[model samples]
Target: MTSLYDADGQALACTVIQAGPCVVTQLRTEEKDGYKAVQLAYGEKKEKNTTKPMLGHFKAAGTTPKRKVVEFKYFAREFELGKTLTIGDVFAEGDFVDVVGKVKGRGFQGVVKRHGFGGVGGQTHGQHNRARHPGSIGACSFPSRVFKGLRMAGRMGGNRVTIQNLRVLKIIPEQNLLVISGSVPGAKESFVIIEK
Candidate 1:
């Protein structure tokens, strides 16, 4: 994330994202696939790590193996198989888009860290051990079992999150980078899908 000066000469915080240098690998037609969508593939992979079946799929598209393949449904422009798309082709400065990606994964966590929960007990009067612990789950006999959907200490993070309406701050076509307003989910090097 960085800050850039806008036309008003005021500093605007932004995050530069590598939007794409995606390739069209497959096309979905209403008559054949019952849906209209374009399948775009990105990120290169070694031939040794890819399966034989996938090798054939990429061969048919006249491209090498790619790691991430996503289907997008839009008709802004006609896409051709084996065609490469850059940030400039699909987006321009001032365009608003939605970014979808997986959030960073944290191993099993307790309620205080996972759910923004306050500590169960105070630090004084021998309450030191109980501060970080989750309090009693529920009643003793009324339900017998803990009700579902109860927020408690459990696995957390590593969920798919979507940030909507982020305005495009700038576009650097030479390097195929997009600068957008605000932060996005996921760890560094994680893949994300941008939608208009």
Candidate 2:
């Protein structure tokens, strides 16, 4: 994330993203695959690291093995196999887009950090070492067992998250980079899908 100055000299915080130079690896149609979607491959990978079948797949597309391949449904644009797509081809400045990515994993976490619980409130009235405890999990014997889907201390983050309607602050077509307003999901160098 970085700050940029506008025409009015106001600093705006934004995140710089390396958008893409994605290649069209495969196309799915209603008749052939019972769906309409485009499979795009991005990022380069060594051929040895890729499986034999995937190697054949990339061979069919006339491209090298890619680190990431994703299918986007309802893609209206017509593209030929082995075509490369850059950021400028799909988006313009000021366009609103949705970014989908996985959030950073926090591993095991307490309720206070995970669910924003108040943490027993200030250690008052003989409350010792119970600040971050999830109070009162269940009743004495009414339900008998712990309920399903209870919000407690457990694994946090590392989930697929989408940030919608983020304004496109700027576009650097030459470098295939995009500057978007506000923060996006995932850690640095993580792959994300940007949708119109």
Candidate 3:
């Protein structure tokens, strides 16, 4: 993340993202695939690391092996197969976009850290080491079982999250970078889909 100044000298917090130099691998139409969408491939990978069927698919698309292939439904423009798309072609500076990505994984977390529970209030009233405990799971008799979708902690994070209405602060067409206002999901170097 970085800070940028506006024309009036006001600073804005932004996150620099490598937007993409994505390739149009295939197009889906309503008559054929029962929908209208475009499939784009991004990043590079060694041919040896790619599977045989994926190699054939790349060969059909007239491109090398790609690390990520994703389909975007309801894309407005028409694009020919194997055409490369850069950040300038898709998004501009000051455009509002939604960034979709996975959040960082936090494996096997407790309720205090996971659900933000203020465990057991304070250390008073003979509370011994039950501060971080999630008090009172379910009822004993009656229905006699813990209900579904309880907020008890298990695995945390690593979920698909979308940050909407993030303003595109700056666009560097030469490096294919987009400086977006506010934070986005996922760790550094993870793949994120930016949609307008």
Instruction: Provide the TM-score for each candidate, comma-separated.
Output: 0.94, 0.95, 0.96
Candidate 1 lDDT, tens digit per residue, 139-196?
Answer: 5888888889888888888999999999998999988899989888898888988999
Candidate 2 Cα errors over 4 Å, as ranges: none
How does residue 176 of candidate 2 score in lDDT?
97
lDDT of 3 by residue, 64-154 (tens): 9999999999887899999999988999777999999999999999999999998977888888899899999976997799889899989
Best by TM-score: 3
Residue clash pairs of candidate 1? none
Best-to-worst order by TM-score is: 3, 2, 1
State model 1's lDDT. Answer: 0.90
User: What does the lDDT read for residue 152 in candidate 3?
Assistant: 92
For 15-34, candidate 2 gives per-residue lDDT tens digits of 99998999999999999999
Q: How far is each candidate from the true structure, as Cα RMSD in Å? A: 1.4, 1.3, 1.1
Give the runs in model 1 whose Cα sits over 4 Å from its true position.
none
Ranking under lDDT, best-scoring first?
Answer: 2, 3, 1
